[model samples]
Target: MSLFPIFLKLTGRPCVVIGAGRLAESKIESLRAAEAAITVIAPRAIDAIAERADAGELILRARPYVEGDLAGAFLVVAATDDPAVNRAVFAEATASGVLCNAVDDPPFCDFYFPSVVRRGDLQLAISTAGNSPALAQQLRKELNEQLPLDLGDWLADLGNLRREVVTAEPLNESRRLLLHQLAQRHVCAYDQCPSRLLAREHARTNPIPMEKA
Candidate 1:
């Protein structure tokens, strides 16, 4: 299947999880990291989930999920061990037009959770289209080992420099090319960086028209 990858902003958005076992707990934690407003419905929960509930991190309804449990939810995770319960939740979410993931049951899922490698604000996600999660996880491990821990910090500095350059430079092909060149060079946000100094000199010498700059 062809999947369209995306990054979602889940802050303050309502999300539901239909179980509270270990698998479900992982999903809940990921949602929590995104600052989603979470509600978990299960007849029983593991200690960690219960503690989070008591701590007011999320709403816990210690009962079997009933109809309307997914009301107003942006997404639902059917993480129950029982296939019937997971299917039921998926059906309800489908009818309500909410995204659903029936854990480990790829055919019933509207989305699959990917194995991710994170470094500060940088995230690399890998998926095998539900074909092989193990392979995706292997790839994630390889990438984590290869990527530098400080890459995200450097990216942040590059982003800030780009913003400043865009504001000061002219709107032309030369300026556009310079931005790409700057990205290729090992340059920091400092004014003394060789690439930045060269760019500044170039801008001074080849000034664009006032209306275009």
Candidate 2:
């Protein structure tokens, strides 16, 4: 299925998960990582979940999923092992126009969690469109190994330099070429030093004029 992939910022927003097992625990962790305020509804929860609830990390309702639980939720995850309960949760979420994800059920999910690799502020996500989650996870691991640990820092530096270049000079073919050259030359340097400073000095020396010869 063709899906429009989009990244969401859920910091401090309300999210609900209708299960307390391993799957629900995983979803809760992911939401917490995103800084979402999460509430879990299940008849019983694992020790970790119970602890989080007790610690006020999340709101845990030690009861079965109810129809009104979908109210005021920004996102919903139906992770119960019981198909009937999962279906009910999906239906309530759909009726409320909230985004829903039913674990292992693509048709019932409005969104699917991707396998992610996070480094500092850099995040890389991989998904198989809910087809093969294991493969997606494997690819994420492979990419984590292949990518350099310092790449994120380098990228952040390059991004700042790009913004400066764009603001310092108007957009034109010559300016574009200069930025491209600079990016290609310094995009691999993670540690900022006199070498990078010298490189920038040299790059600024020869600005190609936009006028045709």
Candidate 3:
């Protein structure tokens, strides 16, 4: 992939948005999901954006874009109706070494937002490298339907069992196998899981607590 894909920790980090229209509202929502400290700049905004500001979800500048609005920002979104405004936000953000996305303008964007399927902590992101966002959204919809709604709960349970196996088994191979089996619990025939017995046997044989992940 030309673009390196990685999840970022943006919680409480400073972020700036240059618009408050519909497109900008979507961008702000994405930032809010990551718990970023967002500041929106626009003379007028849609009711949703204004409501968010009133709710203290984000700060509203109530003005047009300024030359140094991008300073001290970790990331910026330029989603104004004016192309010139978007480009200006990108230029300022770039000069200040901050990552910026100029909405639908690929050349002005440092990164593109992916179509995401979020199930608790499990997030699957799909991108077409800005070629077709509609296709990405379509795939996301399909995956959301196929993936089990309670998959996150199952994963959490499996995690607890895997940690127990790590403490119980002396050899890495045995622990690995036990963890692997626990992962395959969903495929167990009938109502009983054969791997649970094996995991317990190993724990009974070697009772040693270990560090947790």
Candidate 4:
């Protein structure tokens, strides 16, 4: 069966990471970037992870995994070195109906963390279905170089214009086509103001006709 692709809303949501090694640290960083409230469980934390905990970046619980640790969590990550512990966490997550990721174990994971590239509010995720994470990381690096830093800002501007157009105009096939074309054209442009204005003018000029009663 194919794994389903999902984008979760983690802002202000509780996320539990059951490990404190390098892999767990990476997961914590990613979750922090998404503004998730993170709680990490580990008997021994590495220097970097300890520093983050000391700096008040994440909440660290210096204890072993317990049964109710997965309770009230929106998401969980199992990155321990022990395969048995990881499997146990996965089972608990499944029983609780919480999304879980067992690092480097595709069979045990409900979701796999993808190598990601972030530019402001824009994010690109690349996954290999656990077949080759190295390849995914390499592709993400290549994409990082290809994507301009200003693209995120441009995308945000286009999004705002799209919302305005959708609200101001009637929903019709012609309007939808025009909007799609405008979005595609402006997304690739460096300067968005002119393109946005042109789109608005085009929409104004081609108003949807009302049928006679």
Best by TM-score: 1
Q: After superposition, which runs of candidate 2 have C-alpha atoms over 4 Å from their true positions?
A: 159-213
TM-score of every candidate: 0.87, 0.79, 0.85, 0.84
Instruction: Compute the lDDT of residue 117 as modeled in candidate 4.
Output: 92
Give the C-alpha miss distance for residue 8 in model 4, angstroms: 1.3
Please give, for residues 1-213, the per-residue lDDT of candidate 3 as tens digits: 499899999999999999999999998988999999999999999999999999999999999998999889999999899999999988888888999999999999899999999877789999999989999999999999999998877666666666667756666666666677678775222234556566788778665546532
- Top-lDDT candidate index: 1
- Show how many residue pairs clash in every candidate, following the order shown: 0, 0, 0, 0
Query: Looking at candidate 2, what is the lDDT of residue 53?
Result: 96
Cα lDDT tens digits for candidate 4, 1-213: 466777778998999999999999889889988899889999999998888889987889999998889999999999999999999999999999998999988888888898999877788888788888899999999999999778887778778777767765677777788677776765433434666677678678766456511
Model 4, residue 35: C-alpha shift (Å):
1.7
How well does candidate 2 score on lDDT at residue 187?
Answer: 58
lDDT of 2 by residue, 1-213 (tens): 787877789999999999999999988888999999999999999999999999999999989998899999999999999988988888998999999999988888999989998775688888899788999999999999988797778778777777655655555776677676766754544446543564466447644346631
Candidate-wise lDDT, in order = 0.90, 0.83, 0.86, 0.85
Question: What order do you get sorting by lDDT, best first?
Answer: 1, 3, 4, 2
Kindly list the per-residue Cα lDDT of model 1 for residues 1-213, writing each as its tens digit.
Answer: 999899899999999999999999999988998899999999999999999999999999999999899999999999998999999999999999999999999989999999999876789989899888999999999999999888888778777777767777777888888889878867676779887787777678668668876
Report residue 173 deviation for candidate 2 (angstroms): 5.6
